[model samples]
Target chain A: MDENNLIKMELTVNGEAVSMIVKGGRRLLDFLRDDLHLTGTKEGCGEGECGSCTVHLDGQSVLACLTPMERAIGCSVLTIEGVGSPTNLHPVQAALLDEGGVQCGMCTPGMVMSALDLLERNPDPTIEEIIEGISGNLCRCTGYKKIIYGIQQAAQELQAASPAGTVKESVE
Target chain B: MLYRKYEVAQTLPEALSLLSSHNGAVVRPVAGGTDLILQLHERILSADVLVDISRVPELRGIRLENGQLVIGAATTYTEISRSDLVLKNAFVLAEASKKIGAVQIQNMATLGGNIGNASPAADAIPGLYALQADVVVCGPNAERRIPITEFHQGYRKIDLNPGELIKEIRFAIPAEGTGTAFYKYALRKSQAISVVDAAVCVQLSDGVIKHATVALGAVAPTIIRSPAAESVLIGEPPSEDLFDRAAEAACQDARPIDDIRGSAAFRKYLVGVCTSHAVRSACERAA
Candidate 1:
């Protein structure tokens, strides 16, 4: 019953294979923030309602607060840091800033993660899809207009990037 | 928050063994920690020990066995929604899975945990009940099966014994020709608990209801089946008048308690509306 009898677990976080052992009930969100010192993964509701703790478990977005540390054993995880950086912003991240999507900054990480996963799965999503994609995340500020528009702008930018390869193919 | 003890068994046997040693403990089996995490932080539960079943490989994946689908306890809602078998065969479950929590919650919450948690409004309950689902559990002494109807003991209570884990949920395939639908009625579209939820399974032939199963959730302490409504519609042509009568009968079992979301009166109204909608939607699918 002593939770500290830890087991060394091998996991790939942000594309790097790592190992650790803390406690049996240590939440994945806590492990990321407290152990790995990746505090970008915020915890809001702790329950599944708020998406503030969103992270990617093997590429699909999931609430990190709800994911057990043991669930991540021998699996892959992608935090907000994994997706984009300030120096090299993902299209969604860039739009969030340009479109003024950040307000309180609590829900930005989850919103961006959701949008990134959405675009990867759906190259071009409708407005309904955009709304549905971010439905789980609760943003106290911004009224979500900027966030939706940001995702739309990011989708267009991604589309614009594809035409270059298409033009090159035609020339060849 | 106060610090609490946590335990992760390397193997399920060890976990079960730990449970026997500590009787009458508040230990919980965690797949997606979403529910437990909130319960712990809120002081609703001290969480003396969180048995991390997620690390066990045995509790994962979705597979078809014989005519039933065997879902591993750790298989996330995201996986089930994307599964071709669940999409094609268990469309109701797939639909329900999509609306559960959010994409983030879907990626962590598992079907077994959903049932094991026994939330009145858990998306999987009504659909699984409509499908006439069976739960498989592995405990220290033996493995046993319980029908979904008998699974929930009360609000936030399940019949599962201590030192036991939900192994899989199984349901038989539809007879020859049939279709199903799950309807969730919440004030908001997503990321909210249901005011009322309904699932309908109907098989039709010659423009008549050959058979039907109707189930409702969140309107009672436990998920309730509308045997009265189902009886009225079976072998009879589903007409507007009949739909109205069936809905009224189903509403009888709905014991909605007043809360912030809506008044008990509204939920009572929803029982009728959701039941009718679920029936109509299911009929359309069958057609």
Candidate 2:
């Protein structure tokens, strides 16, 4: 590694403050997977076409593959690992499990991230809106019907969980 | 990892200084990183130093200044699409912003990046041409404003000097009797590059077209104004027949080439279709 080419970045990932020296041009996806050892975020297409690299940056969904580490400085990033665990899954994750949304599992994390962002912006989205919300994510398995159902179920669960009717932040 | 150094500029002067003082090293200003990062990763473009201007305070936000919509170059597409001022003042731009790629791309892509990428098929550019937008570019010496038409030289080419960076984009707010609309023909409703796109702004006085502009994308080397179509509608009354004639004239101005996304003949045909539809919609809104 060339020390002169290294950049020091400070950012909040999954609610933890991280300060480290990384390659100036290192992508956020590489930082998450290799440096932080958070492998939940998947990279389907290195280009921006596939949404497999979706993650939350400052509460908005963005493609990690296209986002450089320098861009993440002083920003808050949320990953799939931060959203939930096996013991207690996020409502979207649990709903997908119950609704049979996961098949190949490659698109699940990005699907969940985009879904959460959709619901955050629009608490009650129609079927067409759900499709538009996840339009960036390409899922070859399950034909998307089951995934749509899972998102609907997740919206219902989320609405029920928050009786106050406030926008639910995806991560605490 | 194509760049050897990344430096975030907190202000516009710092960005300009960094860009100019690179000492012959290839330097590029990165905002949004949706396009430049991809090109860098694919080895299509390389830079010795990258200046991050995305966070520069002077290069973010959208505001109304002296009856013109001033949008900082770093403002994201998502911000433009959702802005109340943009929706009310320049709805065609907002509409164009909404249809670029999808939600994720919208969140990261910026209008300046669209211009900087200089893609003939850029979805947001046709609207700028129709609206007669201007780009403000800042350099180490001074800032200059260039009209949208002159800003783009050719496919993947813009009029930016080596030490200059785009500062903001601004356009006069359309009058109350004016209407504008944008139409894009892509393979899909989302995430597909445009095969052909058109944007029209019509000003009507007592139900007669007083002024009009027609712009098309992906059918030429750069987003082009259809003077033939504009002349056809400038003094005519709004009607389906007249719009069709104007569209036919617009078709004559297209210089499209056969590509994977579309063919020259099809693109020329769609120019008429898109222009006619966009003109009709704009006239309807004007009425």
Candidate 3:
């Protein structure tokens, strides 16, 4: 936009200020993986055919492969790396670990990203909604039954934990 | 081969200026860049300069002005599906918009980009045709409005010029006696492209057909209206016989090809089936 101005973008990623010099064509997935060293958002298909590169763009789930870095300049981004660790666990991470949801773990982050969006929209979703939520994400392993099972477990855990106070207001 | 440098245009004028300067140099306006990028990856299409226009705020939102529902060219399918205005006033548009690709695709794929792509199986073409939408196109020097029916010239060609870009799509809201509906026949419910889709908007006068616009897609090189079928509904009483005749006539306008998605005969059959459903849906809404 500002050819001369050379946009100096500043954003918060995983609760940290992330500043980077991004071109118009640089997709957010590339910037995160290359510059920020956050390889959790795996790139399955760079053209958005697969949701393996899903990430939280301003708290909404989107395919990072299609999202331009310029748009994420001022937005909040959260990848799988930000969600939880092997030691400390988010409910989804915990459920995914507890269940055998991690087949190859290639599409896990994207599935989690999409499931997070689903939970935000429909907290107590049916099996169909859960299936619909992760349909965009392509998982080569687990036959998707385990992933669905993992989501159900996570929903139960999240519901019991009572995130009404933790869950932010809907962006709708 | 898919790799290329990108230039983001924050303003409409700047984007247009690039278009004017580039003469068939493989420059394209990127909205969601979903389909375009995939086509490039598969070596289906090629572009040198991807003029990023996603940041242009001018090409977004839906509004009602002068009895017409005006939608910005860069508005996403997700935005269209979620808009209460589209759900109430332009339900057919919303219906088709929701069925496009999946959630990730819908969240980024723009309505104008889909229309401009000029593909044979575009989900929104029939809906826009049923609405009688006017595509407002802007070129270097001036702008003009072209009806959606006449926008496509061939299978993958459009009426757009070298320096032109679609600014907005506008159509008059349906009248009090009119009801609109759109139906898509895809392999999968949400993600798959349409095998055959139909949009029917009917205007009835006390159970008599006052006017009818029946549009069908994916059954021909481009989306088309069955003049033969539309004529039969001019003054006839809405009934099963009318629907049968309309569907039959609608099938006559189709010339589908046997592709990986479906066979020519199957698509033809779907034209009739979808037309019947579309007519029934609109009739129910009108009733």
Among these predictions, the greatest DockQ belongs to 2
Residue pairs in clash, model 2: none
| Alpha-carbon deviation at B1 in model 1, angstroms | 8.1
User: On a 0 to 1 TM-score scale, where does candidate 3 land against the true structure?
Assistant: 0.89
Taking the tens digit of each residue's C-alpha lDDT, what string does model 1 give over B231-275?
977997778887788789888878888987888999999989988
Candidates, DockQ: 0.49, 0.67, 0.36
Residue B21, model 1: lDDT of 65
Task: For residues A12-79, write the lDDT of model 1, one tens digit per residue.
Answer: 99999988766555678888998889888898877778789888888888877766676687789999
TM-score of 2: 0.96
lDDT of 2 at B137: 94
What tens-digit string does per-residue lDDT give for candidate 2 at B243-264?
A: 9999999999999999999899
Highest TM-score model number: 2
Ranking by DockQ: 2, 1, 3
Question: Which ten residues in a row are the worst by lDDT in model 1 chain B?
Answer: B1-10
lDDT of 2 by residue, A12-57 (tens): 9999999998666789999999888999999998899879999999
Fraction of native Cα-Cα interface contacts (under 8 Å, chains A and B) also present in model 2 = 0.90
In angstroms, give how far residue A102 of model 2 lies from its true place.
1.2
Error of 3 at B3 (Å): 5.6
DockQ head-to-head 1 vs 3, winner: 1
Candidate 2 yields a Cα-based lDDT of: 0.91
lDDT of 3 by residue, A67-99 (tens): 766567677999988887778888887788778
Clash pairs detected, candidate 1 = A3-B6, A66-B33, A66-B34
